[model samples]
Target: MDKKEDKHKVAEEPMEHTLDCMSRLETMSDEEWNEFFSDKNSMSDCSFLLGYKEAKLRKEAIKPNAEKAWQHFHTSYIVPETTRRHMGIWIYPLATIAAILAIVFILKFVHLNSSDIDVSRPFMAFTADHAPQLITITEDGSRPNIIEGRQQRDGILINDKEADFTHASFAKKMIRSIATPRGKSYKIILNDGTMVLLNAESKLIFPTSFVGKQRNVRLIGEAYFKVKHDTAHPFIVQTEKVNTRVLGTEFNLRAYPTSDTHVTLISGSVIVCNRSNNKAIKLCPGQDATLLGNKDFDITTVDTDYYVQWKDGYFYFDDLPLVEVMKELGRWYNVDIEICDNSLLSYRLHFIAERQASIDQVVENLNGFSYLSATRQGQKIIISKKMHLKSD
Candidate 1:
């Protein structure tokens, strides 16, 4: 045969092989399927033969049994082969299963094309690790002596060095501050046994070890506090505009630089006092106090879950304004959100989503319930109203 004819015949071989394999699969009993998959060379040959384009199966709808076959093969036939000679048997099953899954996935993609897949709500499609938590500065205007942490079952575990409180060196009172940049969070146990969950873009400054009568710390961002009760020595969280005093209680404090400061009491009574005016307000469980930019305090009843959900690795928005929602998303995703229209800010949305979910997934969920659209350009996410198509 001539070169052109031989080339055509070679091209047709893969297609013919694919058809033959499919025909065999149609009549393959459980024992035969196992036998076919049990052989390494045959499995490899099947994989090469079933290449998507060569099979000419892209245009065909996935067979109803494809999913069932995949499930059965995945759970039963894909097992480890003891002999080294058949090691490829173990690997080839996975490749064949992946090829089968691709077909099912392609069918779903084709089916969804007719359904609504909102393009305006673009998702990031990629995942990113949480930003690193760092010790920016320490008391005495120096850096931390040592900073170390590791992932644990509960969360990231921060290591703390024990200080000799009784020694004369401790009399000097050393303060240490740890900060988590945008897109990361950390949990640290203070020297006093108080546990603090610091949210992204937040900082906590406390002594290397508690000393004297008062256990005090200054906060520059948001944190959930589980203070260790010391009746004789009160725990104080000093913010930019307010100070929260607690003997023993669970509460969440938010004091972002550009936003109003808030203290939400979860389980105990605490006093939130304004720094400038020394005006103090006692908050009960489920109560929240907001310190406005003007230093005016607004006390109201609130669901504490909405405030402390970040510690639990979720963003829980309950009738929260669109602007506020975007602000929170921007912080956790480490992106800039620009709202093109001010009216969108008035729209309220309520949803609960994992903090680690990609920005695209969040935007998709958001667009599903609201008339909003988000587009990303570099690190900025632009929000606007979704355009409606008129029906003829």
Candidate 2:
């Protein structure tokens, strides 16, 4: 699917309304069911079809003994007396028995060992460890950790298969993470041996371990991932609106609070997916995935050094506007940024500086570069739009 198709799907109906409808229908009384069945609508067409088909089988059921008698009555009887037709006839009941027998046969003997049971079971579990988990399975065959136990129990059991992450699904594990504010950084290692360093205000969701044929994780905000390579297992990451899939590679995905999607690949191949449209595009070494809110998502080949320099101590920029540069500053320094004018938002600045120094040093570097001046007011930094021009 394309971007336009994804937008169309989102605009087709009110998501809130759909969710409310589903909630109401999840449990309905006899009166409520009758009211629903009486109404004809294209909206309810899918649900109605399911219910109607199931109800039909119920109505077709007949007694087993009656069905046997019906089969015997149909034996090759040519005598007029035996075959005589009557208004109140044995054939009617006999036919019903035969119909029921056929229906039962079809239900019991047919559709065995098929991939027909795709159902969702709605339930939850609470445990002391590994409570919040996010399990995902990739096309290339990787699994996510669900909960610790696939069942409920009073005592702890380590040897049970239910306690294993490899045997669970995302729905079962519910792996999740909490976001921290600016000036804070944390590191965690996943069950797959992959390491993730989360920047301030970033959250990630992943299985504690792999389960199925593939590995998948979800992230919110800025984080650097060093994915462990497994030729037999593929790794994937999902963000708010896109997906990044890779096999044994290192990449940094930055879906910040202020910017659109900006995925910088350091080394290794990655695939970005847009789930709404079922579309995906791959990126190579020294490439970036740029998703623009006002434009189509695109990929640009660039210097990976400038994109991932934050993982080190330095902040690097290449033809990057000042507005973007300040956004990073606010996050790294744990300060608020305020511009005097939006027109200066287009001012482009390119430089490299260590993040350890105070904000004054950063501001001084910009001030010394040109006559452009700035001042600090509380947590905000106000900058000048009007600049002195120097000419030959």
- Best model per TM-score: 1
Work out the TM-score per prediction. 0.60, 0.54
> Which stretch of 10 consecutive residues in model 2 shows the poorest summed lDDT?
119-128
* Cα misplacement distance, residue 78 of candidate 2 (Å): 88
lDDT of 2 at 59: 54
Candidate 2 lDDT tens digits, 1-392: 99978864654454334334444543767566445434545244433333333444445543235434323422311111112111342222323222223333343443331112211211111001222223222222334333332443222122212122233334344454434446555565666668787775676766655678788887888888888898787887888778788888888898764457778888888888875675778888888888765235688888888867776878898877666677677776656665554334446778789878788888877777563566666555666643533110
Per-residue lDDT of candidate 1, residues 1-392 (tens digit): 99978976786676566445555654677667667667776555545554534344444534344445434432332222211211333434333554543333333455432112222332222223344534343446675543544322222234532222222235455766777767778776776778888888888887767778999999999999999989999999998889999999999999887677889999989998998989898999999998765468899999878999888899999987676787788878877676664335456778899998998888777777646877777667777777651110
Any residue pairs clashing in model 1, and if so which?
123-360, 139-175
lDDT of 1: 0.68
Off by over 4 Å in 1: 1-139, 143-172, 389-392
